[model samples]
Target: MTWIHLLSKSHIPFSVYKMYKGDSLIQPKTIKNTHILVILQGILSMYHVLNKTEVICNSIVYTGHIITSNDSDYTYNYISLRTSYIISLPITTTDLNQYIDHKIFNQILYNYNNTLKQNIDINRIFIHKNIKFRLIQIIIILSMKFGIIHNQKIMIPLIIHKIDLANILGGNINTINKILKDLDDQKIVTYAKRNIYVHNIVFLKYYCYLLR
Candidate 1:
């Protein structure tokens, strides 16, 4: 089931809006409306702009994410990585608490838990690994989430810049450049024409020896 399914019985008021590429889904400031932001379509990336650099807070949110500001202060900034559709539904903690004991809520909880597990996996994969290994592992994770297979190669949906990759990896641009070079040299992955294509998954997996 999808978020739409969960919202079917919801009488809470909502407003749907289209966000083009480069639009802000949520600004870094407090909001009067305690609305739950839902990704209706396409991919969205959560980012924090620090010292004029975009630090990735979350990987591409594929779907089923409910962006909420339960606290009084809200400052999470979300940007459209691709053209996307989104809706803001006004909700309260009381309203959410009421649904906590249902089967539908359990399924939603599972989805959130799955996303948490992916983050944990990423942290583990990147920790203490060399730049080349971390770079390859990240490509594998992105491929699993957003890749399309063609000619036995995996094509990811978005343009991947070295800086963006660096931000995701928590590394410097020069290091990411070096790692990208190594990945290309090893035939593990390559980013070109605003897209990343994984050339060989089986060989890449062997290189990473993914334990999970």
Candidate 2:
């Protein structure tokens, strides 16, 4: 699918494509165009070549984030998912400048620029709490967008791995393991293999402070 077809009315010029493992996706060279990835399913990891850092896992990359390709020669990077639906917008700086609100865009641009300036540790502490909030937000957004399949109970085809959660939460593998164990102890979630069974969504909402 093309960006025109996905976002039919928006004047944003983009192209949409489905990618899987070994698809020869773009390697990590910087480009003038902006890409937005809305994950329909599966997982993905973005790695920064210059710093040798992985930005986030299973993250839905939006307009605000800056990324580098794993390969230097190409304008794209490899996606670490079995399958993903992605939209690439061939946008000029002028087009982006006009579309994005100036203040927010400036802030994002500043952050991206700063990120490129130094070697960033993937396990930084400055954004720990904010990272948790964002991870929960992603869950809420996915819940609303894709919803759950009805059976004797409600289930979502959550194909996420522990390492992926650690990346998204900006924590270590052991930390994520602890968190999942805590959640399991509370009976809010159950996991088997790579699938997460949300047994108690309401309880989870309260536990995560999304509800009171």
Q: Which is the leading candidate under lDDT?
A: 1
Candidate 2 C-alpha lDDT tens digits along 1-212 = 22233344445565556766434344446543355333333444453334455343323332223443333443444454356655555345776665645443454466455434421333332244754444444555445444476554335465667776665566778876766676678776655686666666676667667521
Relative to the true structure, candidate 2 reaches a TM of: 0.54
**Backbone clash numbers for all candidates listed:** 0, 6
Cα lDDT, all candidates: 0.66, 0.50
The TM-score obtained by model 1 is: 0.74
- lDDT per residue, candidate 1, 111-169, as tens digits? 56755675567667557447667777777877887799877899998766677667666
Off by over 4 Å in 1: 26-33, 48-60, 69-74, 93-104, 125-129, 210-212
Off by over 4 Å in 2: 1-16, 21-30, 34-50, 53-82, 87-137, 210-212
- TM-score per prediction, in order, is 0.74, 0.54
For each candidate in turn, give its C-alpha RMSD to the true structure in angstroms.
Answer: 3.9, 8.2
